[model samples]
Structures are given as structure tokens and as C-alpha cells.
Target: DLSEILSLHDFEAVARHTMNRRGWNYYSSGADDEITMRENNTAYQRIWFRPRILRDVTKVDFSTEILGHKSSMPVYITATALGKLGHPEGEVVLTRAAHEHGIIQMIPTLASCGFDEMVDAAAPGQVQFLQLYVNADKSRTKKIIEHAGKRGVKALFITVDAPQLGRREKDMRTKFEGNASSHQTKGGDKVQRDAGAARAISSFIDPSLSWKDIPFLKECAGDMKIILKGVQSWEDAVLAAERGCDGVVLSNHGGRQLDTAPAGITILPEVVAALNQRGLLVPPGKPRFEIMVDGGVRRATDVLKAVALGATAVGVGRPFLYSMSTYGFEGVCHMLQILKDEFEMNMRLIGAPTLTDVVPSMVDISALKVPTVGNTMFGVNYETMYPAGV
Candidate 1:
């Protein structure tokens, strides 16, 4: 039946019906009113393609390197927490799927499976990256970084956006709905609060993580390319490069950390422009200071749009989760195959035989001339889901 699933949304539709209510809400809900979440995808609509004609498009190669690691396409599996919530096998399902597809996977700091377990699951020479949530305890964080280096984690994508978990009310409401033990009513105000799985699982994150800690992290990370993920503005992107970070991911934590944050794709041009302005886009004879983006990427066309704008690659998270949750390994593999098919077909239609041909001119950003508010706000016409009997 999964073979009949044509798009990522099909997988999502299946996930909504089959996964538990808690898992479904947790996986799909965004922070606050979810404006930024919707904006993340819709913003892509503003940029139309200026596809060129008459190019030798016989063979299309979407393969590219991320921080020098070869990937089948300019796409990598971005880290998402609590995989077991949706699938019985948890994050390892994604690990195996990435292997089958030959794409890179960023292992999350908080995975249901042990760190070594996922790393051990990898095929020989399969490159993995670590998405670290710096613990309050520096020694523990250092140990994780060092261990990852020894395990051959090629990069450290230190998440810088979520100092504290955001309010994903849909997840919280369902998380807190019912099943309350009445014993708490007898207590003299010693009851613990349930702020949903997001806060419960992420309590140890150090809010004091500042620019000063980069050098310490670099020292701990050893040879792993240190990339600061969740960079929102051009300023932070520039700072990361200047401070010796190998690259930066312009993200808003997939609109889960900060509501109303601009989609990463919309900001990619400015980030690239600023990085080039400061002469830090790529230093002489050094590995290119990779600028990646994630958030609101749904289609392979969205991936190409990001590629066209200066992103070395794009990170996709939810679609893979939906696939994995619905049908496990085969589901994830099939979803990836769909992307692979789209990449080749779209590449040809757009007259891009290779990623090099996916230059900036291929996209017409004139629609982006309006203010970001206009670009976002998918409008009151934007439909929203509600609980039954609401």
C-alpha cells in the first residue's frame, strides 16, 4: 500500500490516522499560534522559477556534499527529538533509512536509543552528524562531543535556537488532557507540572549558552566540523563564521522554538549576501563555509529552490517522521525514493542538469520584494484543525 503513496503529504495523512493521538499532536503541532510554521512552507510560493530552456538535460545528478560528505541529493535528515513516540523502533529507523538512501542523518542529542546504539547501527563509512543540545554540565557535554568524534561523527551541529522549549499548545493540551491522578488534590501544593513532552524531556538544556562557549565546544569537538544550527539572522551567521565555526544553519528551530520567526529560506539570500560582504563566505583554500537552511521544506522543488539560493543543502524532518511512523523502514525508504524521482524529473524540467546549473538566476525573487509579513501570513483563509466536539 505504501508503494501507492506518491507524496510526503500522503505519508502524513496516513500518520495522522494511524499514529496515537498524543504522537500525532506532538509531531504535527507548532509553537504558539503556528503562524511561523505555516509561513515556513507558504513563503516558498512567493519565489517563482525562471527555468531556462535548451540545456543538455539527459542525465540529472542531484548528488552533492554536505560539509564535504557526499549525499545523494542536497538534502539531509534534520534532527527531530523523541522518535519512539511515533515509531516503536525510534530514531534507529531513520538511521537505517538514511543508509539505504545514501543521505546524511543528523543524530539528535536526545534520542530514545542510546548514542552508541545509533552510531553502531550505521553501515561502515556512513557519515553521521551530531545535533547537540549543550547540557548544563560542561563535562557531560564535552564527553559527548569527544565520544562522537571517536565514533566518526563528521560534524557537530550545535543547536543554538531553543534555549527553552516553546509553547506547543496542541501538544500540551493533549499531553495534559485527562488521566490526572486525584492524589495531587490532597497534596499541599507539591504537584509537578506537565508542560508537554517537549519540556519534560529537555529540562537540562543550558540557557546560558553564549558566544563565549564556542571555543570550548571547538576544543571538545576535536576534528568534527562545528556548525551552529538555528541561526536566524545574517548577524549570527556572520558571527559564527568569524568565530571559527565551519558553517551555520539559518533556521528558527522549524518554527517550534520561536513563533513568527521568518522562514529559513526567505532569509538565505540575505545570509549569503552578508557572509560574502564580510569576505567570510569561504576563506582561501579552506573548505567552503557551508550555509544550510531548514524549515517548511515539503517538496523536492522546495529543496531545489533552497539549492538555487546558496544553501549547500536543506534539512527535512517531519515528512520522514510521518513516513517512518506510518510504515516503518519501507515507508521511509519509499518516501526518499519519491524525493529521488522528483529531484531528477524537476531538475530536467527546470533545465538544470546538475546542481551547478541551479544558480541564483533560476529563481525569480521579485515577489520577495514585499515585506516579509506579506510573504508570510498564509492568511485567515488558512485552515486549522480542531478537536472533535470543539
Candidate 2:
């Protein structure tokens, strides 16, 4: 079965058929009309590569560092919640696979497996980061952050977009069918009625999170690096740098939170320009503030395009989860291998032998504009899902 899979899209197609409808919808559905979700992937179509030829293609290296940690490529496994919904082993599968591949994994706060357990599953010296969903209870949030620091998490990615979870209609419909599972507390007590996974699980997240809270989170996190994960504008990116965050992920929470938000890649140029204008771009070979992007990255070329636009690196979420859902740890391993292969070939073709060679000049993004209307193309077409079922 692993041999049969070729592209990241293939994993998604197989996962759709193999996973339960509840789980698949939870992973795939975006907010409101799902326009932003579709745009996240299709936005890549507007950017084209300006590859070079006649370069020495004897060897190429894809290895790079992320947030002061070395990685085998210019991508990391971005945070995704409730991995147990996809596989029995949950986030541990990611921990193991990331270790094997020499990359980093951003462990989610709402992981099915507890934080310590997931850390325990990682191989010794394996680098990992923690994605924090700040709790309404400040003391509880502080304890969790301090715990992650003690547990050797390399960084803290505080999610800033989701003050509240978005309404994913598919998951809501699944709940209305009485098939959704209830959220439970650590003592096996039911916390609330099920309203699909996102809302039910995210009820504990603090709604009043703001810029003023950054210093408090930094203080709570001790010496670990602090980065905001859901920023969508140049203004916030500048403020994040001003607030002394180590990095900012220009994301719309995978287009799952706001339906009309710009794709992460589309806004990256402006964010980079703003940061540069403020003298915030990190000088080469320094471990300072970085800019990262995520959302609708399905290929090595997508990663390459982001790097060309001044992103330190790219974050990939859904494709790896789909791989895990389809074939467990082996599938994850295979998926990473596929990406590694693609990066090598693409790098050779693009005439960028090193990560530094993949610069702004390598891609043409002149046609990239903020979408005024939803344009549906490649990956997870939501239109075909409902067909007059009433």
C-alpha cells in the first residue's frame, strides 16, 4: 500500500475513504463557507517558478535549521490537534517519524496523548516544539508552559487567531446526526455537551488573549523562545517583533478560523517587507526573529516558493496527518521520504544547490493577489460533499 502512494494528494484521497466520516470532516472542514480553505491551496497556482539551468548538479543539500534547531529540510511538521482521531498511536507516531527523518514536530496542546507521554516517545536528542493554546485559567496555562520548558521543548508557538473556534458545518452536521464524541476531563468526567471536536475541545482556551499577554507568556515560558502562530497581517507581524517574540507564523490557522482570511503565502511578501522595513529580519546565520508560513502546502515546490519569498521555513500540517491516518508510522515515514526526494530533484532543477540559493529571484509571484472571490482548485473540494440530502 505504501508503494502505491505517490503524491501528498494521494494520501488525502485514501484517508477520506478509510477514515470515519466524523474524523475526516474534523480534519478537512474549514470555517463558514470554506472559501479560505479552498483558496489556501489554489493561491499557489498564481505563483510560478523561474528556474535556472546550466548549473553544476553534481550534488545538492536540503538540510537547514529551524528556530535554532537543525533540520533535514526547509519544512517542519506543523501542529495539528487530536492525532488519536486519525491513528491509535496519536502524536507519538509523529514524534517517532520526525526523529527518524531528522526534522522537527510541533506538538499540539490538545494532542490526544499527554505532553509528557509524547516527549517520552521521542528518541533521545530529537528536537520538538510545543504549540500552546492558552487556558482561561492563567495559573493552569503558566504551569503548562513551565512544564513544556522543563520537558525540553525548543520553542512555544502561542496560537493567536482562535479566541474562539470557527463553525465547521460538516462537523456540526455530524454532531446533529448524534455521532460526535463528547469532550472529557482528565478524571473521565464529561466537561460539556458535544458540538463537534473543535468547539468542544477548545472551550477552555482564553478569549481575552492580547498583545499585553505576550510578556506574561514569555515570563511564564522562562528561557524558551516565544513565537506567535496565527498572525495574518503586516501590522501584527511588526508588533510581534516589537514585543520581542523570536518569530511569527503568518497563518490563518490553516484557513480554518476565518473564512475570508488571505492565504499565508500570499501575505508573506508584505509581512517580510514590513519586518525588513522595521529592521527586524534576522541577519544571515543568526538565531534571531524569523518569519514562517503555513496553510495549503502540499508539495516540495510549495516549500521552495515560500523560501523564495523570504520565509525562514514552511510548516506542513494536513498531508502528514493524512499519511498517518492511512498507513500509520510507515505512511508518515514514506511521506517524508517523498518530500525529501522532491526537494532534492526540485533543488537541482531550480539551480539552487543550497538553501541560501533559493532566494526571491527564483520565483515569479507577480500575479498573486488577495482573492476577492473563492477560487476552488486542487485538494479537498468541499462543493461535492453535500448533494441535496434533504
Candidate 3:
């Protein structure tokens, strides 16, 4: 049954059936209206490809570096919280899978398993990055950063989008539902309570997180690359670069915050352009600042498209979670293998013998900004999957 799951979307279909109702809603639903969530996928459709022919593509390479770490592909598993909602092993499942495949995994601050536990589960010498949700207490935040630094975390991604949790209506509706005992904590306490998983777990995120704290975080991080996650605007991206931040992930918190925020891929050009205009887009051979994107990356073609637009790499979130939920560690490995196959085939078709060969000329994104009706297939399918009033 797991072998039949050939695509990332297939993993979602299985996860929808296998995961409990509350967990599914929490992982799948975005903020109110869910417009941004839908757009994240549809926007990719707007960018058409211009495949080249007559190029010898006997062997193609998908290997690349992210934040100075060697990865087998240009994609890395992005951070998603409360991994136990999908699997009992929590983020450790992803840790093992990513290590086996020679890819990086970003450990979530609010993981179901503790930070140290997840790192301990990793294969020896496996590269891991830490995603930080700044705590209201400065000392608490400092301690976490220092501990992660000691644990051999290669980078520190500071989440900047969620000072306050968004109103995810699906999760809100599921709040009164009974907790699944498997997801409970050591003290027999439910990891989530009445406020729904997002709100309940994010209470410690400091609302006052601002530019002034960047220098303090740099001091705490101590040589680990500090990248700002959830950066949307070109202005903010520019500021992140100017402030000595090592990189910026152009994300909207997977549309979980700010319902109408633009898709990460949609804003990639502007961010790259701004960085270039300021001479901050890292020059060749320098340990330079990186640009990354995460949201609605369902295929290897999506990864290729982002690279063409000048991203150092792309981050994938829900797909791996759904994969793990549906088939555990095997599902995760299979999903990566599927992506690898797709990347190879697509890269050859696009006439790119290597990742660096994937240039801006290979894609046509002129229709990206035009306001047209988006495909409502996801909405229709979602409604069919969870019909109104149950």
C-alpha cells in the first residue's frame, strides 16, 4: 500500500484518512478564509516552463548546498510543529529519514518530542537546523539558543511571522474534541487543550519580538547562521540582510498567520532583486547570505522553478508530515525517493544537467502577477473530504 503512494499529494490523501480528525484539521487548515493557503499552490500553476531541447542530459545532478551544508537535493524538510499529531515518534521519524537521504531537517521549537530527544535520535554526523519561536522570557530564549548551539545545530531559523496565532477555524471547531491519548505528555496532561493546538502551544511567543532583538539573538546564536523565517516584504528582507542576519526564508508561516499573505514563491523575485540591488545577494564563492522559500511545494518541478528564480533552496513542510502520518518512516523515505526520481526526470527534460544549469531563462513567470480566478479544485476536494456539518 505504501509503494502505491507515488506522489506527495497521494501522501496527503492517505494522511487525511489515517490521521485523527482533530490532528488532520490542525495540520491542514490555514487562517480564516484560507485564501492565501489556496493561492500558495495555484500561484505555481501561473508560472509556465520553457524547456530546452538538444542538450545532452545523460547524467543530471540534483545535489546542492544549503547554509553551507551539503544536501543531496535543493530541497530540505522545513519545520512543522507538534509532529506527534501525525506520528508517535514525532520529529525523530523525520530526523532519521532526512539523515538517511543526506538532506537537512529543521527541528521545530514546539515539537512533540523535546529538542534534545530529536537530536539524539538523528544519525551520527547528520545535519540539523533549529527553528526558534522566541519565548517571552529573554533568558529562556537565550538558554534554548545556547543549548542548540552546543548540540551541533548548523543554523538557527528565528520564526518572525507568528507573534500571535491566527484564527484557524477548522482547528477552532475541533477544540472541544477529546484528546487522543497517544499525543499526551509525561504528566498525563494533554499537549493541547481548549484553545486548539496552535494557540495553546504558542502562548510563550513574545509579541514584542522586534528588530532590536536581532543583535541579542546573534549574540546568543554564536556563529550559527541566523535566518529570519516568515519574511514577506522586500523591505523586511532588505532589513534582515542589512541587520547582519545570514538569510531570510520567504514564507507566510504556511499561510497559518495573516490570511492574505503572498505565497513564498510569488515574492521570491522581489526579495532576490532587493537583495541584489543592495549587493547583498551573495557573490560566487563567498560564505554569503542565502534566500529560501517554503509553501505549497508539492512536486520536484516546484523545487526546480524556485531555483530558476534565484532561491538557494526550497523548504517542504506538510508533505513529509503527511507522509509520516500515513506510513511512518517508510512513508518519509518513499516520499524523498519519489522526489528524487521526479527531480532527475524533470531536470533532464528542462535541459539542465546540473542545479546551476537551472537558470531564469528556463521558466516563463510573466502571468504570475495577473489577477485571474484561481483553480478551486482543492476547495471542492476538501469539502468533499469533510462535508459540511459532518
Which one wins on lDDT? 3
Please give the lDDT score for candidate 3: 0.85
Over 4 Å off, model 1 = 176-193, 372-390
Model 2 over residues 239-348: C-alpha lDDT tens digits? Answer: 99888899999888888998988898888877776677667876456566789999999999999999888888889999988999999999999999999999999999
TM-scores for every candidate against the unseen true structure:
0.91, 0.91, 0.91
> Model 3: runs farther than 4 Å from truth?
176-192, 283-286, 371-390
Better by lDDT, candidate 3 or 1 = 3
Give, for candidate 3, the lowest lDDT window spanning 10 residues: 377-386
Candidate 2 local accuracy as lDDT? 0.83
What is the C-alpha local distance difference test score of each model? 0.84, 0.83, 0.85
Clashing pairs in 1: none
- Tens digits of per-residue lDDT for model 3 on 1-390? 987887999999988888998789989989999999988888899888889999999999999999999999999989898788889888899999999899999988878888888889988899999998887778878988999999999999999999888989888777734333211122333345686777666555679999999999999999899999999888999999899999999999888899989898887877776677678887556567799999999999999999988888999999988998889999999999999999999999999999999987677776776644783312212122222422
Residue-by-residue lDDT tens digits, candidate 1, 79-125? 98777878878889999999999999998876766678889999999
Clashes of 2: 0
**Model 2 segments more than 4 A misplaced:** 176-190, 283-286, 370-390
